[model samples]
Target: MKSIDGISFKSLSSDLPAGLVVFLVALPLCLGISLASGAPLVAGVIAGIVGGIVVSLLSGSSLSVSGPAAGLTVIVLNGITKLGSFEAFQLAVVIAGLLQLTLGFLKAGIIGHYFPSSVIKGMLAAIGLTLILKQIPHFLGVDKDFFGEMEFLQFDGRNTFTEMTYAMQHVEKGALIVGIISLLIIILWDNPKLKKYAFFKFVPSALIAVLVALGLNYFFRISTPVLTIGTEHLVQLPAMDSWEKMVNQLSQPDWSAFKNVDVYILALTIAIIASLETLLSVEAVDRMDPLKRVTPTNRELKAQGIGNFISGLLGGLPMTAVIVRSSANINSGAKTKLSAFTHGILLTISVLFLSPFLNLIPLSALAAVLLVVGYKLTKPALYVNQFKLGWEQFIPFIVTIVAILFTDLLIGISIGLAVGVFFILKANYKTPYFFHKEQHHEGEVIRLQLSENVSFLNKASILLTLHHLPDNSEIIVDGSKSTFIDYDVLDAIQNFKINAHERNIRLHLKNIPEVISTNAH
Candidate 1:
């Protein structure tokens, strides 16, 4: 096969194996996200295909993978419930896509850059913890609810810890055995010696774990009826014959719902949350890239917009740049965006020809793979590294983890952001300006340097300094360091200049722009 774009055939070789791994990872996640969001199972699969093929084709990112995000699950579920139907929710997805497209054109993607590194790290850890907590039930065959609900309070009224308690009481022996074996296989496959072997290099640990789990389950079915896995403990894709039947399964949007005010509000909410999640995931993926290639954030937004648009048109859930799938792609040794495209192709092929085989794979195996993913995200080293950065960073990081674990993604992020802002404001309040005094032949010489960004919060301090300036002193007000000076501060400085002349204080201004006097006089 020829290379895509400028990527080499050698790269495609690596991408092919990585694509298989990602396809394996994306399958269960797509279904689970759809289940949690109250959308049709087919909707999530369509989104995975669109995100991989369409978004990967349009995206400037080489490694980031786009698909249904767990972060949007709550919003989607609530939207569907409020809109009264899946069709109406699909309409909202379309509107959200259009809104994201507008945001891309407006260059709103830069907003991602403003998020503190601590907060981003916290978000990553929070997702990791959420994954571990949510998957525990599935790992034990406690299929009471969907597999990918990240919220602490589930739709079924069971909290995260409570669900674990329930799962403990009703654990399936067969599923637990499969899950433990799969997790052990995954861990063993990560051995350095195994990685060095040519045969093992071509095989992804997750793929091996899944195959072994499937084999073990089958063996149990034939040999020990009592130990056989139940249907609910395994995947359950809808059986279909012919391409026509697959297409017939697709649901259409309710165009009449466009005029509803609540629909528009839901659309806006999805647009903002999806875009934010996409941007954050893009940032995180870029950091994880081995080559450290930077993704064009605005381009990513545009690509996600188109992906969501196409997915919504085909009765699919909303799409975003999902970190989980992207991380799997990167860790599996993917080389180019072609890996994502290949995964999309594989997803379609599996649905058409391999559904029965896929259905045979136990959910516990997938849960084991995700557990590994979660551990990687929340490794002890990361926590220790954050702690070493001092309390300024550590406080927000810990708070984000706690908040997300107790609440939802958006609320947790909002809390972390508020805390980060408090730190910034505190620092700003203390060091709004630099003042240095020197004794000279002509009385005291004072040099005042304004901070880079001086807002109204710094106005009082600046005013106080000006008021206390000794008479018959030479003072220099330097704005050279400042990029922005709030009008309130500038007005105060101007008033001081007038008073300085009358008080025999010589005041000099540097790099400070003249503003029109706002005084009525």
Candidate 2:
């Protein structure tokens, strides 16, 4: 048996370098996701820490990093409003975490297995596209809103297109100049000539670009021409007068909310959504793994559950196995869960030690990094490859992209799934069904022979055949001609047997037990 279920730390040193890389990438995302979610900035950091330390210890993934997910921003934002208080919402997060823990115990991770491959591909591509599109405004020094808002038009009445235009019109010369320079440095760092340079080879391109940009800002002392990330977008820590004060920042859920039916519904919603995102990410990360590491989904759920519970206790946002952070980890050459743990530790240390220094990091520089990240995701090759797979795949894939851009992530995916299911049914309907008439009586016996594979989509056609069969007719189902019969179809056939027996008709099934007698009539 192939074992795909254990973690080993044979090369802990390698993980540290990768972990530092992931930590740098995660810091901005943690803060930005928190801002997008309308939660306290520290909340995002807390979730990142919990995801890193707790989830990493428990999760099945070797390279995947969990944290406050951009996908859950809308849910958190709306949840706070609906729940009447942030503390109240924290309670919901706790419940949701426990629910996920229960789901893990139930081995419900199988749900991830059933998602159609095409849909998963479509989703990943769409996410990549969205990430690229959303990051462009930031790269150009347009800071009207935080990252990953679903609305093409933002709360400030500026659409993505408008933001680009606005940035061009009121271009901060300093910011634009620095951003363009940073972009050039990043591009150069990846160049064949510069890649071999000993100093540049191991150093991250983003870190170099950021350092150069920051140096320019300091040298010129230029306050104008560049849009700096203001206090509004920066991570904020709770006023820690003492240890007790810091703990006071954490909130306990009101047990009273449990009495309300909506609370349970919310809990289920979080569990389902969080589980889906985590499982999908696991699949994606596995596909990206150079070593072909397969993560256990049930263990992943438990990891995420623990992360979320700790997040809730500390007044942090809910956690999920986010693709963005996970991808960053993979691309950065992370080898083990140690990378995740270290990233969390970095998040903790930064807030505690180097927060003031972090404040110096230009939003435009971060934007430049994300812009590259986004481009990698939504590259032109993805579209071309998806299209080559044929219209059935292409249509849903394109629809998913459009729906995500126009509506939101969840809605767009639902729309894509519906269309995909329709196509499956249509294809099933076209499958030939053979009918054979009896040799003796007039329209008394008929035999139905199915194709190689019978799916649930064929249920309606089979049901219709059974419904309209003549009152005294005999029916025989032949699976010898079919390689595989769906469980639903088998159940339908068994149910028909009872009906046929009651009506004095014969129901015969071939290639199945006890369906026929050895003696001829």
Candidate 3:
């Protein structure tokens, strides 16, 4: 074991095993995301390597892992088609990186802070559901659509439910068997007794399951040829011979597309979305850290920006800090960022030397791994807990999930945010001021105390209260505790003041600036 910069060499054993686990988890995902994004398979692998190596080295987060996020699959696909070619889209990725760098320098990473807790939780749950739904087809060997594509409506015109129907009709017995066995292995590995053993602790369940599935499929191919998993149901990495061939495989960005206005727009969009996903993932990962380590958000943004820049130059997809990979890294017993870097190195080595072996792993096994991941994210407990938090919290959470399931991630979150804001406004209107009424010898005495920092959202409530004052009542509009009040609210009060004489009410204002009547002005 060795130690460097607070990362102990003693933990190398732990880190190495964890890295291998993350590498296994990332392999199919990179290929799937790339296929979904309409980019070449090599592009996804390149982004995965860059994210694990470059971004991890530069990020302040100890456990957060970076990769080609599934969240960006839809955006990347559209961007590529709209921009005409993959090479042109790569230029947009470069510009997006530069824009992300600018945002980091400007400290815009704080944008994550404004998202409601409900909305964030909702996003997580939505993604989990998406994973489970999207992977079902792959698990059954229905390869009509790209694997790992999470959008509700797929590009091939098949939605989530429709894909399940298709999968049912086109079920491959070999894949179904592998997927079921792999899922069983994963479930069994989670047993506390099994996990206590050194071999089980060091070796990841997913890796073991995959290897077992591979052996089973290989045996079936020889013994029961008809039951063998076909090429469409397995991983398909581009095999390389020498370093020169690998270098030749790298794609270059089309600089000539730089002048197109649409390219810049796509760049800005990618930068914004990628930055948001990174910040959200970073926040979520920090919360998951057992040590409760806090990550520097701005620094993370800058790291991702630099990563995307390098990836684009080398013909890779856009990169972001992904919650799935990061959570897998932590759960696999990673101690530091070294695990992430190790994963990258493993990915590179696997691509260079073990591509043929990787190609033999069945997609069903990978889908089983993702199914477990998705189940963890959208566990029943999460919904129960959210429901207990009251409607104000639960509504947005549920709404976000449904919207994301029906529409898309960004749109779903937007809808959830809008609903959350409506609740906030309602609460503000209900509690902006306290109205106390007392009966007096002369008339009813009404005392209204304004809350601090009252805003225009309270205007309607204030107007209604003022209008319903009993005839010949004494009303006091007090702003002594308020540091600031919106002009709309103030104007409503002034109008009430002007009408007091006609309504047979006595009006008095305290510590509130008088608003001149329009006729007087």
| lDDT preference between candidates 1 and 2, better one | 1
lDDT string, candidate 3, 1-521, tens digits: 66664366677767888888788889888988998888998899999999988998889898888989888988898999999999999999999999999999999989887788888888888888988888888888775676657677877788899989988998999999999999999889877899888888777888899999999999998899878998988888888756787788899999999789999999999999999889988887777688888888999999999999999999999999988788778877788889999999988987888999999999899889888878888999999999999999999999999998998877898899999888888788788898988788987789999999899999988888788778878999999999999988888788778779887888999999887656332
Q: What lDDT score goes with residue 359 in model 1? A: 93
Q: Where is the poorest 10-residue window by lDDT in model 1?
A: 1-10
How many clashes does the backbone of model 2 have?
2
Error of 3 at 300 (Å): 2.5
- Report the number of clashing residue pairs per model: 0, 2, 3
**Winner on TM-score (1 vs 2):** 1
Predictions in order: lDDT: 0.87, 0.73, 0.87
lDDT of 1 by residue, 422-494 (tens): 7776666778899999888867899999999999988878888888888878999999999999998898898
With a 3 Å backbone cut-off (N, CA, C), the pairs that clash in candidate 2 are: 172-225, 175-226
Q: Show where candidate 3 strays beyond 4 Å.
A: 1-15, 290-292, 333-335, 438-442, 513-521
Model 1 lDDT vs. the true structure?
0.87
Off by over 4 Å in 2: 1-14, 148-153, 192-199, 222-248, 255-261, 427-453, 460-477, 481-521
TM-score, structure 1 vs. true: 0.92
Per-candidate TM vs. native?
0.92, 0.82, 0.91
- The lDDT of model 3 is 0.87
